[model samples]
Structure formats: structure tokens, C-alpha cells
Target: MASCIQIEGLLQSYIDEEASVSERLLIEEHLKSCGACSERLALNRATAATLFEVWREDQLREDLTRRVMAHLPEMPPPTSVSAALRRQVVVEGQRTRRWLGAAARLMPVFTPVILIILAGLLWVAWPSYYNMGGDEVIGMVTYCDANPDATHYSQGQARRLHVRNPIMPDDHFETGEEERLMLSLAGPSHITLLGQAAVQVRAPRAIVVTRGDVFFDVFRDNRRFQVHTPDGTITALGTSFQVSASKAGTVVTVVKGEVLVDNETSFVRLHENAQTAFTATERPTVRQGIDTSPYLRTARAVRPDPDAERRFLTQFIRNATHTPAPTEQVFVVNTERRHVNALLLKWMPDPYTSGHAGYTVYVSDSAMAPVFKTTISPEIFQDKQNNMVRLEMPNDMRRHDTHVLHITVMSDQSSGPVETTFTEVAAIGEAS
Candidate 1:
């Protein structure tokens, strides 16, 4: 009979089906005789099953990323374009000089007149050179989900786009289910599309996304990249992010660097590993962490960089413990006594804290003396990314006067109390 310690050492190998025939027989015989060992084996089996499922899921995700990135159009080195242009210019200049030399030999008197004409021609073609510079290829379709099914609409005609097709300004690409497209853009940016995504390429440096989820791996330079959505616009200096658009709302997740989400009602900035969801009606609600498994998987497909996973894990672990509670500068709307139904307070707490012991809202008629007090439950803060607490104002307390509201966080740790205060002026039809 195998001892527990011996069985423990072989458990993983046995679960993985990596044990030899003799080892398997021994483990099986031992498991049959000992109930505790059997139970332990059963638990190991369950854990193995769970791990296998997770591994399978990861494999599938990795496969999808691989296929998508493999299809991205190949981009040549950055110096290629300028080098080709310079070669062309040199060739043209040589031809012109040769022609001018022959004419000068034939008619020395008219040579000066020909020189003036040639100079004028060069000046006339200068704008064409300027326009050619603007014609820098921004993005190319490296892979299309289904070459026949995917359609590109440009210049009032819809046609199928194949691999190596350049995506130009005003070009609209739409994909169906089971169809994905990958784009290699300037700045060495990469974008992958999934699930009925429709993206329109805009001039200069912008993309308009009408639907679906798109992942971006953008390299930051001096230029700004922008994504226009139905609910709002996302602007990034240089970052890797994912934007998902649906009927419900738009969600932006920043994997690396930061981005600014702006709509008519609100403007919010999201940092690395942060996420935010925006709706047409509501304000942007910020969240702590973003699930970057899909993006990271796709990035690995684009370029198998071992450091990418290490960096992600490192940042994730650091965020869990090191991120401080966020302080917010908020503007209070509808502060009029008659219109103020509730005092809305929004904040973000440190996720590493054990638990919150509820909060107290102190409303004072004067800065020194408190007039009203409201205590809120910790339930108001639980599992909330953007913590919002709304306390109803008493009819008597809603006077046409300026009041100071103080909020303090109650926690188990002795790191000292976290508190913030804002002054609210209650005047009819006025907000301050």
C-alpha cells in the first residue's frame, strides 16, 4: 500500500494521466483500500477537471487570437515609403537635367527660357507632393473573417475586401458572425474585430465604431487617436484598450496607458487597468479592474512577447494592494432647495480594505455647526466600482441657503479616517 505522502507526490501525475502503467495500478489499488485517500483523490479529480476546463478555454481564446492576428495585413518598415519617394524624385530630377542639357546645346539662347519654364513646372507640382504626403497609408486589412461575406463600403459602392487591402478614409468595413477582421494601422497600431463589428475609417487619425467589440493595441507617439461611438467618443494619447458597443451602452477598458471618454454630459479619464461604462442617459461610471484576457491573448498572437503576460500579472497584483482610494472632484447639479431631492455622493474605495463600516453625511448650516446627520449602510459601498450614495434631503433642511456637507469613510484599519467635504449652495434655479 502506498503511504499518503507517496500518494500525494503521485497525485498530480496520476490526475494528468502522465503516470506509468505500474504507478497507475498502485495508485488505483491504494485509493480503493483507503476512504480518506479516495476522498482526497476525488477532490484532486474535481480540481483537475476544473483546471482542464480553464485550460481549454484559454486554448480556444489563444487560437482565436492567433487566427485573427495572422490575418492582419503585413506592414513594411517605416523607412520604406520615404526611401521610395526619394528614389523617384532623384530619377525624375536626372531625367529633367538630361533633357535640359540637350536643349541647351541645341539652342543656347532659349535655354534660360526653358529653365524658367521647368522651374515653374516644379512649383506647380509642389502641391501634388504635399498631397502625396497626406496619402500615407494609415491602415490595411490583414485578415478578413470571410473574404466573401465581409463587405467594404466606399465611394457609394459595397464590395468584398480581401487580405492586403488598404483601409482608406471613409471606408466602412462590416463583419458578420464567425467573421473577424484585423487591421494594421500606422503607429504600428493593431485592431481586431469580433461579433458583428462595423468600423468606419476617418481621415487624419480617427475611427468611428458603430457596433460590436474592437480591441486596440496602439503605440503612443505625439499624435492622438480617437474612436467615435454612438454614446460618446474615446480619445487616447497612445494606449491599448477595448471598446464594446451595444444597445445597452458603451464600455471602454484600458489595458495600458490612459484614455479620455467624452460625451455631452460627462468627461471621464481612465487609467491603466481601469474600465468605464457610459450610457446616453447616465454619467460615466469608473471601475477598478478590466478583464484583459481577450486583448492580451490577441496581442500575444500579434507578437509572442513573454514580457506582456509578466507585465499584466505584475500590474494586476500591484493594483490589488497598492492602489489608493480615489479622491473625486465632482460638480453638484440641481442644488436649488426646491429641486434638490437627494445629495449624490460618488467615490472609489481602496479594494484591499477589509470592509467598510458605513458612512456618515454631515450637513451643516455653518461650517462649524452641523444641523442634520444621515448614516448610510456599508451595503451602499459593496462591490461597487463607482460608489454612489444618495441621501434624501429633509424638507426642513432644504432651505434656500448654502450648506456644507462632510463625508467620512469608516473602515477597520487604523490608517486614519478618510474624509472629504463639499459646499452646496441652495438657491432656486442656480448651481454652484
Candidate 2:
């Protein structure tokens, strides 16, 4: 025999007097020792009894309604209209009783199911109910390079934000002049910091940009992705846009999707390829279909490293060399790279040049064409016999970004083949 302790379903059958003799005896004996089971049985019995009483009362009411109709017919067969109306009333009452009987039978089965569904709904809506603006990590630094360049302030000290670093609410991301930071948000939203920018993630789904050019590509979401600026706020449901902030004001350019730009006075909805500008105290001036190509091109462009660019320029100049080239060459720039661009020294050794001939060193930033030309006489050589040349570049090196040096031998002696060798080995800087 199955144990009564494990037979919760059997209680219903036992209360209905439908259990076998042996099962009833087992339950009776089990209830004597188990207070919880006895209480549950009593509650079930009381509920059953209550439902039975309600059903009996309804049946009695239904029977009395039928008896009253039968007695009224015996008293008088009324007019045709009255008799037909009475018949309709009796039919409707019978239908109502049938419906109520079915409903009462099904209520017990669906009551628990309805409660479970309601509980699930509440659980799903819990966040919205409490307005959980907690510092939960919604996303991480998906692509962050230039270590110690892009940083976030934490506990009075600035910490570097590297790849895979989790981003929390109120987390501030500030980049140096040369650094750019990329972040991914919860809605699969992407933010690309192109230049020197300072941004802090506000609670939930918003970011405040204080400076620099920031590109945002937010995927579709129920919650809006907000970009808070000094001038106004740009909110989007699903869009790719650019926000360029400066001292003058902020300019919002819509690249693909639509966005709403709100300021102190009013709000304007901007569509694709539309642009708008706003000042700190004023509302945004809307422009429609006004080509956003400039911002679009910039958003798609990658920032080249200054050091790598300098090296490429050096190699281009060094490629135009004949046999027995100058074995020694040096190029050096100041260490203060981000804030300043200065070429401190550039020394190239030419061993075969004539001592009496004047030399010309052509310089350019792109190495495509010479923008500057410096003529050096043989008497100016630091080492005369060795044909060593230390020609001072055009004084505009500090003003411009001088990368490549093209030294063409301006031999006043005998211009045999126009000797040219811009030998660039390694440029070492002085104490910076």
C-alpha cells in the first residue's frame, strides 16, 4: 500500500468517501500523528463543504424558479405575449445556471495557474517597478588600446580602461589628446571617441559628453539611448549619430537613423543626413538633408599613429638610394609628442659629396614633394674631410610636422648624376 504521507491527492478521494477501506484506515492512522497533514485535510474538507453548500443553494434556487413557473401556468394560461415572455425568462435562467456550474467546476483547476502567471509577470517587471538605476555593469570596453592613455577616475585615482573592462554606471572615460576610446553598451550600442574626449556614463541608459567628437551607434531598444551635452540632449531608439562638442556649442549629425534633439525651449526631430547645431543657452537650429558626408567620412576613418607615420615617411625618402649609400643616418623628434610636435635633430652622413659644392636638402611632411629647401655650403660641414653634413632644417620645422628629408646634392663642382641619398637609420632624441 502507498504511504498516506506521500498521498496528497488521495486526500480528495478520501474526503469524497471514495478511498478503499485499507486506504481510509491508513489515512486515519497517519492523520493522528501528522498535524500538518491533518490541518490540510481539514482545510480541504471545509473548502469542499463550502463549495457543496454553494452548489446546493444554487440548485435549490434553480428548482424553486422552475416550480414557480409550473405553479403560475396552473393558476392561469395568460395572454400569448405574456406566456412567451415568461418562457424566454425561464430559458435564460436555465442557461445562466449551466454556465455558472461549468465555471465553478473549472475555477479550482485554473486558480493556481493564474496565480503563477501573475507572479511571473511581476518578476519580469520588477526592474521597471523599482526604477533600478543601480550601478550594474551593462557593458564593457570592447576595444581600448593605448594603455594609460584612456582612463577613468576611480577612488581619487585615475585608472586605465583597457579591453574587456566592465563599464558601470557613473563611470567616467577621459582620453588624452592623442588617444581614442571605444565602448559597448548594454543595448549593443557602440561609442567611438575620435579625439580628446571626456564622457561619463549616467545611470541606466545615458551618457554625458562634455567634450570632443563622439560617435554613437545604438541598436533598437525599448529604452532610449541618450547623449547629454552642454547644449542639449539627443535621444534615439535605434540610430547611428555623431555628436561633436566644443566651447562654442554641440553639433549633432544624423548618419543613418532618426533622433530627437531637445534643448531648453523646444525639441526637434532630425532624420538621416540631417544636421543640427545648438549653443549652451539656445535651442538647436535644425537643418534638413544637408549632406552629413564630412562627419560620416570621419566616423569611418581610422586615426593613424604619429610614430608609425613618421617611420613610413623616413622609409620613403630612404628608398631612392644607389650602391655605396651613406651607412649613417639619424632622425629624432621631441618626446612631448601628444601636446607638441617638434623635430629636435636630423643628421645624415654623405661621404662622397664634394667639399666645395653647395648642398640642398629638400624637406616635406608627406614626402611626396619638397615644401622646404635648405642650401648648405661645404664650409658648413661639421666634419669637412669626412663629408659629414649637419644642415639646419628650414626654421619652420617646429611650425609644421616635418617627417621626411630629401637631400639632393647641389654639386657646383660637376653634377655627374645628381647624387641623392636621404639615409635614415634611427633618430635618437636629446634629454626631453
Best by TM-score: 1
* lDDT score of residue 15 within candidate 2: 97
Clashes of 2: 1
lDDT of 2 by residue, 1-432 (tens): 346557677899999999999878888878887778889999999999999988986574445776777767455755666777888989999999999999989999999999999999988866331333334655556455545643776434576656655566788888767667766565546687877788888753699999999988775557788999988899998677899888989999987778999888878899988989997668678888877656655554433233322222232222325222322222333223221222222222221122223445444444446545555554443232232344443444534443443334333422222122332322223344
> Per-prediction TM-score, please?
0.39, 0.38
lDDT of 1 by residue, 1-432 (tens): 779889878888998899999999988988888888888888999998888888986674444777788899878668744887989989999999999888768896787888999999988866321332334545556555555543788645785676655556777887787677776554445677765888887753688888888877665457788999999999998677889888888999987778999987999999978999998667999997767655555533432122322222222222335333433333334332343445666543321122334455555443435546676565554333434666777776566354444333333222222222222322232243
Query: Can you list the residue pairs that collide in candidate 2?
Result: 331-427
lDDT (0 to 1) per candidate = 0.63, 0.62
